[model samples]
Target: MDFETSDKVKLLQEQIERFMVKYVYPAEAVAKQEIEASGDPHHEPKVMLDIRAKTRELGLWNLFLPDPEHGAGLTNLEYSPLCEIMGRSPLGARAFNCNAPDTGNMEIMAEFGTPEQKEKWLQPLLDGEIRSCFSMTEPEVSGADPTGLQTRAVRDGDEWVINGHKWFTSGAIGARFAIVMVVTDPDAAPHQRASQIIVPTDTPGFNLIRAISVMGSTHGGGHCEIRYDDCRVPVENLLGPEHGGFMIAQARLGPGRIHHCMRAIGMAERAFEIMCRYANTRVAFGGPIGEKQFVQEWIATSRMEIDQARLLTLYTAWKMDIYGKQVARQEISMIKVVVPNMLMNVLDRAIQCLGSLGISDDTPVAAMWREGRSLRIADGPDEVHKMVIARRELKRFA
Candidate 1:
């Protein structure tokens, strides 16, 4: 197990890190100001578009997708470190067009979309001309279990009419279309009961209720509430085979987890740096706070936790690259549970070290904490992943 990155990947790492320092970090405040000035919390910031053009100019775009034609064609292991750098600043992912919901959406579409779907929806998304969302989690169902999804789509002639209330339809507000997971056959097996359908946001019955505030902010393309009231789309809009929503969604989640965990590590690393910088410069007890045992312990523990999470995440990426996502299921579940919680631990310590400023939005640490709090619940909750990890372990013993 050689751990060295290839020269190509090493070059990408250097470019992305340099890009972060020069462009993304400075654009953070500009993004915030643009959003504020727009009078719409969910407005697409001008800085986002500016940096995207710059990122394209630098040949740093679409580093997430593994497809050679549309993306950088890098393997999962190669993409992991780059994603961590993008996760450091909140603006980082969009600047590189590697943002989520979009990344996962692009993956599934590139694999399953018909040629027309690719031309109409996928290309624009790939070119950064439009954004899209995934509509799976429903307001009425427990999000942890996708089997309990309640949305319904019934075939009527050439159209599939859809009806449901979905919240956390992430990125829905500005999306051009939604890849909707709906029940096509109620009596079919749980996994086969649903299918994914593409519905243009302008379709008559699709309603954007509002962006549900998380941790007191609804910035960017917010996590939106959408009611699909007898929404109709061409039957040809179905993605993949009939009853394939579960499979497609599962595929999206498997690799996407690696991206999420890496980004969490990046955020934690930034917070860790902020915490240590404060400890070195901020005097307490007639000396630097770094001299204190408690502060030192926080620093030491955070260092260990961050490195552990990164190694485990990178291992999971390597396993996915070497074997496949199915083969790496246990490790995937483990990191899905481990990394986000590890991030919270590191962020909590950093926040405590910085005291009031850590809780304030003046620094990115507080916002990272606010957003990272949801990581524990998103994708799959820790309890759910823990249950999965234990079941696989018990089966091994059995």
Candidate 2:
């Protein structure tokens, strides 16, 4: 893969970086205050609206999708750097209408949704007029093993009735609809048992328990806990083919991991910068902490690790474009384990370098630390991914 960034993506990278500095950075605290004042942690702060408008005006919107009609028409390799810039701030993705769960949902809908389904749910989402969620992980099942999913969706005349318990339904609290993975055929093959159904949040018996707090903060459309107690949507609400939910879910993860890993790298890059600055300026004894051997080592190691993870991430994206996502599964799993752990390693060094200030929210490091911890578990846990990587490698030798 060419190391040189194309003129087009280079321009996008520069614009997104500028957007991050001029808008997302300033809006972080403003958004927090607005949400606090509104008494709704998930409230869409007004500053976000301004950010969105500005991104749209600059023609920097829906960048995650490769669809020329709806998105920036960039391949995974082309989009990687742009995604990294957007990953620097928590608000960056949303500013460009390319946030998670929503991005994944949009991808599947664009590929699978029928014309009527696209007209009703997909367009509004593409336009940023509505948000959506994925309801797949369950409180009762081991999320890492999705084939064991217990949620049931029964055909009831013209409607499908859903019933199950779900937690960590990311972005469910304020979403317009959810793409729910449910068992429509218990007797079918493990991978073919579940189907994805679209359930509007307002549908009867769609019970939203609450947004589960993460590290004592429930901001944005929080990771929600919800239940479908006979919740019903029209039969036409099914997404993709029947018994194809498992395949669709796997399809989304490969590209989504590229976004997640690159974004984590962006956070690590910011934290590394913050740590180096503090090391150089914060004095102890007779000199800057950066002059100390331990601090020097921390900075050196962080730089090496960040660059290594980034190259691996970019390589994975390139492979996904050159080969198909399925062909690049090993690299995908490898990065899924490598990048998040690299992020945590960098964050830990930065935090230790900052001492008390790092543990506190004074710098973005601690928040990034808290948030980055989940990356090891989200998508697929480090253990599961490592196992997959190892198994794939072992099969070649055997």
The alpha-carbon lDDT assigned to residue 149 of candidate 1 equals 92
Instruction: List candidate 1 stretches off by more than 4 Å.
Output: none
Tens-digit lDDT track of model 2 for 196-289: 9999999999999989999898877889999899898899999999899999998888888889998998999999999999999999999999
TM values, all candidates: 0.99, 0.99
Once fitted onto the true fold, the runs of candidate 2 whose alpha carbons sit more than 4 angstroms away are none
Backbone clash pairs for candidate 1 read none
Each candidate: RMSD to true structure? 0.8, 0.9
State the lDDT at 152 in candidate 2: 97
Worst 10 residues of 2 by lDDT: 64-73
Q: Could you say which candidate leads in lDDT?
A: 1
- How large an RMSD does model 1 have? 0.8
Q: What is the C-alpha local distance difference test score of each model?
A: 0.92, 0.91
